[model samples]
Target: TSERILGGLSEQGAPVPQGTAAVISDPVKGNVSEADVSGAAGPLPKAPEPAQIEVLTNPSAGQAAATPVQNISTGIVSAVSGATSERLSSAAAEQGAQLTLEVAAVIGDPVRADVTEAQPVGPDSGNGQSPFSLAFLVNLSGLIGGAAIFFLVGGAAERLEARSLRTSRTGLWTVRLLLGLAYALLIAGAELWVAFGLLGVEHEASTAQVYLFLALATTAAASVTMLLAVAFGPAGIGISAVLNVILGLVSSGGLAPLEALPPFYQAYADWLPLRYVIDGLRSLLFYDGSLDAARLEGGWRDSLWFLGGRSEAARLEDAVWMVGAYLVGAATLGYLISLVRDLFARRERPKTGKVAKAAG
Candidate 1:
């Protein structure tokens, strides 16, 4: 209508429609009739009518033009839904009422969640979950405790072997095993006391399970270091420190998760006791010792494929058992090597005796 009103006026003045009984007095032309105006202007070209938009009742009609409008409408609806949900959530939160915010989306009425609103893995801290807490567990329990046990056991074993006080290799291994168990238990206990008792850190797992994990980790480290010491002497201590402390710390996946590590570290993540210890601690401390809870709450299910596709229960069980395996395997291997050394020493002693007799 505005287009008609505006477009109808021109340089020749406003053109009257046909059959309009209106008098026109023009400055240049003395008087003008409606017929004269219409005839002169060649039936005053009619203004083009605005297009009337109809509802897109079928998919076949104006699909190209409808697509952008449909997208815009969908976006508007989604934004409004999100805002309304946020408002309701805020209101409920203020009233101390618990509510699950249901977000509405455009596609087939599917719901979309705002993941940012989800709670984080560990305790609610101002800065979110710190890597420092994880590092503290891995370094204190796995690296420092493990390395200390290694040196304590290895140094004692070194002194016995140096003084030739190890009469029976079997007896020596038995002593080492007993000593390792004692030291591991003490280390695990002390560390737990420091963490839970002194630091006031909270854990959502059984104390026995956490203590067992730490003990097994330290025992495994002691077993491996004792094996190296019995086989390689003093050099074994350096090797143990490098393997269980330096390399272990890097590959532990405590500071950075397994997926974030390089491919080589990811490949060997399962073989290392440090990785399992850290993973177990994380599960116990924050995830209630349940792999499913960790996976669901921590968002590790899809990303961390190194879990070997085991069920949640199986994975949680394996985390502890694998460290125990390391302890048993290392201890057994050390025992076997001691047996072989004793056998060779016995054979050499008889040959040397016979040679000395011939010389005499």
Candidate 2:
């Protein structure tokens, strides 16, 4: 009996069996080929029987055999999917956080930047000052002083007339004019002292400029008072006091700008002399002196043609002209009223003499 070796090497890469011989079988001729091993030390061993292998086609048995492998593959796929899902969730959270931060940054930027322009000086300028200040008191004092002058002049004229002093009409006119001028000078001087020396009103203009404006304003006020006195006699002092002190101060734009006033008050401000006076004073006190050439040119043209457009400086000049015009117009009106009153007095005198004769 002889032993046969199978094809291929052992685990250590040697031939199959240490002492066995290899056999090759031919299917076509039913013959066996053997390799001799006569030089071996021992007799040959008996050959072993062929292995019996069984094949099964049953579905249950096949599935039972493959169950572990399927389970292992499924576990690997689940682990990969879980890891991918966790990574995706982490990425999504980071993106959401970044987006929230960006949105917050955009929303908070404007508050930090403080985007707003500065307002100009006016009632709505938000300067945080109350309406009643030292400046207001000083202005009110000037009005009271003007009213006192009106009363004093009226009383002096009444006293002169009561004494039967035969003064010519021309002489009386001259005296009234001189008295008005003197009162104007006194008021102007008093206002300068109170505003600058005592109250210390902060102004941008020089002392000379402020004094000039005060003089013009006081002169205008005096002229207005004299006109009323001549036209309505001593009773006109009360009218002058109301016009110059109460109505004038109310519409003067001293407490607020004209634009900020109510519609009714705004309309009244246009006709009030104190409005222009205050406007000119404010321009000289608060406004910068550097003029806009184009604006000045346009304003000059508008003034020449009696048009509406004018800047702050032009408006101040217009105020000076208005004061001058008031002086001229008031003088003419007062002279006419006085002439009419004199003519009426002459006519009444002749009638009174005839009535007395008839009665006797």
Cα miss at 184, model 2 (Å)?
Answer: 2.0
Candidate 2 clash figure, as a count: 0
Where model 1 places Cα greater than 4 Å from the true spot, the runs are 1-166, 293-313, 356-360
**Candidates in order: C-alpha RMSD to true structure:** 23.6, 40.5
Best by lDDT: 1
Candidate 1 clashes between residue pairs 3 or more apart in a chain or in different chains: none
- Model 1 CA lDDT for position 2: 23
Q: Give the TM-score of candidate 1.
A: 0.56
With candidate 2 superimposed using the best TM-score fit, by how many Å does residue 157's alpha carbon deviate from the native? 4.3
User: Which regions of candidate 2 are displaced past 4 Å?
Assistant: 1-106, 109-163, 168-173, 233-235, 288-315, 346-360
TM-score of each: 0.56, 0.53
For 84-172, candidate 2 gives per-residue lDDT tens digits of 33443444455553324443333222111111212133332123121122223334444454446546655676788799653344445
Clashing pairs in 2: none
